[model samples]
Target: MTPDRHRLHDHLLDPSGGLVYHLRALRHRHGRWAPFHRVLAGWLAGWQPGRRELVIVGPSAGYGLPTGFLARFGRVTALEPDPLARWLLARRPDAGRLGFDRLDCLAGTDGLARLAAAHPQAAILFSNVLGQLPAPGGDWRPLLARHLAGHAWASYHDVISTTTAPKPDCAGLGVSDDGSLEAVLARFWPGGTLPLTDHDTFRLGGERPRRYAVWQIARRRWHLVEWADNTGAAPHG
Candidate 1:
């Protein structure tokens, strides 16, 4: 397998690497992740792309993805790095509709464009992996907007994370780039503030309305997950 070039730090490596996230999912999918799964499913259900093929990047074990959702596409390929996740993701009930790819599509300067060229008819999805990736001089968003201009795409990723539990009401909130990260964090943690990590995803959605949710990935760690879709929009040039 090709080495990943995204340069994620150890703390941010767990999910993309697979083992840690798989183990956590086994323990929390039915508990902590239940609400998130529901919200994510609802968000996904609203997306109806014209293509029947789907290419999901970094969908670790697909714990947050619903089998019914996978069934929506005639062909679903998972571009993941974690061996364990690839193994588990393939065995999903809708395994018949799924395939695996070894390409590290985010590994090089033109990787995304290359991937787009390779699967011109497939809808691309950045599955909860964006927040875990380093910003590469804070150019990630622009890079995506530019390269994926003519494709049907969507992404659900982390925007902010903290040890403190955010308000449950923050789930399903619509986030915008106009607000300060501090303002967004304040709404989620109205009781008080705590040390946090901004996942550099705050404005990935631009002024687009994004579905937001809180994910308690661990007992003490929580993440602000944001979802955006462009399946219905005309391709941006």
Candidate 2:
């Protein structure tokens, strides 16, 4: 686990360490974590959907960050697994335009298929939640691959396992070794991760740096991987 994950959870419980991390993400906003999310949204803004539809997965009932940004779209649907999170979100005034569903995204392919079927044209967002998806056999590529196969999607999450690259300020959340994660994504979908040029810096939390990155898989990227896997052969490992 990285220091960022712990730092993000530091304010959740009064005892300092507890299992109430969800509250920290849902309610606390000591600049807890928003700037990076808005940066992700900015990247998403590049591709404008015809219907201005955005399907968010696991926003954890947070508001005025990514959710608020997505709400600008004509339709905003969030598939969340927590009931309490949903309740908190429903209590908000701006929730008028937002739709919440109690969906366990980690359920399986069926659930994901339904999501895709319902919002075929909507851009799917897997923010900070992809790493937490329940994937048996330690392979998360399938979960993401399934989503991209059905819709245009982008991912923003923390890469815990660091490489030679330096970290950013306003730290923490999620965990994964950069090389291993990148290897898996490249193997499944080459260059699927988008490169960040100018990003925002946060100074709310201490000097801890962030090791996060954006992962993307548009229709074209999906087609290439599918074609390579179907005709030529599975992508070379």
Candidate 3:
């Protein structure tokens, strides 16, 4: 591995880094080798774009950067809090194409409100960061409902274990009995549902298997793209 890749791998292995490690790993694996965001942007190409804006929350180095690239069809704003990552993003060529904003964190109702105010008419995309939220008490639904009532479309992705496997039950967050992320999104966005696509599996640590479900919430319909391992989970409107 290159020096940067080795350092990133080590950083991910550190316990204190937490999910940032997995996020980094996912990014390095996908971003370095695949045109993940480009494909996602193509998927969303048909949306009305003249007056629409695209906002990305919790823009990690890997996900956020590529997301910004894919969001070129509209105004893209990236929100992040990490100083080093923010610095790197600022230095990147694509920075010119996006409105990068630094935030303390993208959790709680207040943070959402701030984002809503910053990009009122934009489509919103949330990746792995949603599950990392504090949980049901954070009340993201009302914030989402208010922002997406008629003005915006939002997309979200969450990791789900298999139906027959024992999964960690998050406190204050609901998971389905079948280990489907669809239920989680449904709980978070009551009016939203999961649209089925291809089923794919991701092997994190040999035996620790996880699945991904892509969901879109717009015009009161939930369209699902089922199961694809290593598939880029970009939110579409």
> Judged by TM-score, which candidate is best?
1
lDDT of 2 at 78: 77
Give one digit per residue, the lDDT tens place, for model 1 in 1-237.
333553312222464555677678888889977877888887788877777889998888788888677888899988876767777788888778998776666755667776787777789889988888775456567767777767888999898888887776764454443466666667667755477888888767566666666777889998888787665345333
What is candidate 2's CA lDDT for residue 37?
45
TM-score of each: 0.85, 0.53, 0.48
Q: Each model's number of backbone clashes?
A: 0, 5, 10
For candidate 2, the lDDT comes to 0.43
Could you give candidate 2's per-residue lDDT for residues 1-237 as a string of tens digits? 213311122122222112354554444443533543444444455444445677777666554244446556777787755555667766665566788654444455555565665666677666455443444434445544554454556554433221112223323322222233345334333343444321111111112222333322221211101000101112222
Order the numbered candidates by TM-score, best leading.
1, 2, 3
Which residue pairs come into collision in candidate 2?
A: 4-172, 160-176, 161-176, 168-209, 168-210
Q: lDDT per model, in order?
A: 0.74, 0.43, 0.40
Cα lDDT tens digits, model 3, 1-237, are: 213311222122222223554465455434432333333444345333334466665545544234445436456666654444445556666556566654422444455555655565666665444543443344444555543444444333333322221122311232223344545345434343333332221121112223233222222222222211112123344
- By lDDT, the best candidate is 1
| Candidate 3 backbone overlaps, count | 10
Model 3: colliding residue pairs: 195-223, 195-224, 196-224, 197-225, 197-226, 198-226, 198-227, 199-227, 200-227, 200-228
TM-score of 3: 0.48
